[model samples]
Target: MSELPVLIYDGDCGFCTRSVRWAERLPVRMRILAWQEADLAAYRTTPERARHEVLWVAPSGRVFGGAAAVAELLRSARLPWPVVGWAMSAPVLRWVAERVYRWVADNRSRLPGATPACQLPPEQRPGHRHGS
Candidate 1:
């Protein structure tokens, strides 16, 4: 509800926490919150969606998910980071980035710093259920 943008992620996921730590290292000003503790309804998002992917909720109420959320986070950082963020949002790159993000999200439990909690719930996983 503050003026700063809000970033929501799976708190139980060690990989997600580690990724957030990396994001925190960047010189960006925003609110980073765990989905379990946050009021998802305030962000106009559902718990299921928040559990499944990283989210960026703008102060104005716009929402970005998956790789798009990553791009927005980078855009909030300083200098070269914003450039990288712009590239991520570029047409062809956005397509590639989205797929890469999905791959990472699907395999996060196998990634470094990950814990069993990093694995998505079977019902929330791609192909196992519908909607994004």
Candidate 2:
């Protein structure tokens, strides 16, 4: 089989690399890798399009972006984080998420490696790659 849906991220970003590394170790046992280094043309995103956002490509060819992608990834792993994910569907939560999305988009460059993201702290991040 192909693998869990791939997460396309900027490999050069410390936050992106760190987050992918963390996802790589989730109990879900799936592959989620950095797209900047991988051949994901099949995912059919313009480099310009991808640089601005997180991405997820489902087995059925569904694509998700931003907070939706995050929620899908957590649900794909069946992670407890998805519990909060459900709440995110609520209008108020989604409004907050949209605001959060805008802020992340605006400040992604300030992160380590000047990439648009950051890894969560070691203790709070998933344990597979870091070893629980």
For residue 83, what is the lDDT in candidate 1? 98
Candidate number of the best TM-score: 1
Worst 10 residues of 2 by lDDT: 123-132
lDDT of 1 at 8: 98
- Each candidate's clash count: 0, 1
- CA shift at 98, candidate 2, in angstroms? 2.5
What TM-score number comes out for model 1? Answer: 0.89
Compared with the true structure, the alpha-carbon lDDT of candidate 1 equals 0.87
The digit string of per-residue lDDT tens for model 2 on 7-41 reads: 77655456666667777666554556565555556
TM-score of every prediction relative to native: 0.89, 0.71
TM-score of 2: 0.71
Global CA lDDT of candidate 2, please?
A: 0.62
Candidate 2, superposed: residue stretches over 4 Å from native: 1-3, 112-132
